[model samples]
Target: MKFTRTANANWKGTGMEGTGTISTQSTTLNNAQLSFKTRFAEGVGTNPEELIAAAHSGCFTMQLSFLLTEAGFIPEDLNTKAKVTLEDGTITLIQLELEGKVPGISEEQFQELAQKAKAICPISKLLNTEITLSTTLTA
Candidate 1:
């Protein structure tokens, strides 16, 4: 199966001084404000790296859930945080931290499944930067 999702960005003025708004098809971020200040420094509104982190975390969590179910484990909770590192105008790395509670699964099994999910998640595949994952399996 194939599908497409899109977001639109409208910008004005020069790169350093310009501001923009991003609207997604789902309207979850309708007309969200973004600008150079938001991207490079702490400011009001969102930025591209923040968006990518959200997407990666969500995607990896969902993929892990699927894999857990397929392996006959029911997950009580799966929390993931993605950290995107941008350096010198390039995305250097993405680190995924996962805390999971799955009944009847060993820590090793959980770690293995999380690794598989990280490698196979759509967002992980789409990114061209180094990806590292740390997993915590809890009761």
Candidate 2:
């Protein structure tokens, strides 16, 4: 199976003063505003790192759910937070913190699946930076 996703960005003005809009094929983001302030100075808009974090968190959670089901365990819930660190105009690190509950699975097994999901998730594999995972498994 093959899948493709697309997003478009339109920007006007200079880097320091420029403002832009971002849109996705799914329309999850439609004309979302972005600016230098948003990326660097906590402005009132979305930024690339924030988008990356969202994508990573969603992808990792879904992958873990599939892994748990494949292992004969029913997944109750999976909550993940992905933190993207941008430094000196470079994306340096991404940390994934996951908390999950699944019936009939030990912590060791859950952690193993979490690690696998982190490694194989499409966004994780696409990123060229350090990735770390912290997982908490609950009964």
Candidate 3:
């Protein structure tokens, strides 16, 4: 199962004064110098880091839900947010937070499922960064 999405950037000049397009659709065009950069989440344009975080969070939550269902439990609600922090010009995925509710499941069981899902999820696999995280389950 090989999956892929492509984004290419063409920078005509230096770091701050360059511009690029992600994908051929021109749906996402950016110029760092002009501050015309469009955020991936806003869907107003293109930003690579936002895109990466969105992908990670989306994939992880889906994987968690499926795994929980396979474990004979269904989540009442599942919400996960992943933060990809770029600090001092170095990018690091610093934290992840998962909050959810599952009926008739022990905290231990919930944690077991969460750990399994986190470890095996495609986004988690793609990440080489260490995660400082927390998860909460209730009801």
Candidate whose lDDT is highest: 1
Q: Rank the candidates by lDDT, best first.
A: 1, 2, 3
| Prediction 2 TM-score vs. true | 0.96
Worst ten in a row by lDDT for model 2: 36-45
**lDDT tens digits, residues 62-81, model 2?**
99999899999988889999
TM-scores, all candidates, are: 0.98, 0.96, 0.74
Please report the TM-score between candidate 1 and the true structure.
0.98
Of 1 and 2, the candidate ranking higher by lDDT: 1
Better of 1 and 3 by lDDT: 1
Model 3 ranges with Cα > 4 A deviation: 1-3, 8-13, 24-46
Lowest summed lDDT across 10 adjacent residues in model 1 is found at 106-115
> Candidate 1: lDDT of 14?
92
* Candidates arranged by TM-score, highest first: 1, 2, 3
Model 1 lDDT per residue over 48-97, tens place: 99999999999999999999999999999999999999999999999999
Q: Which prediction has more favorable TM-score, 1 or 3?
A: 1
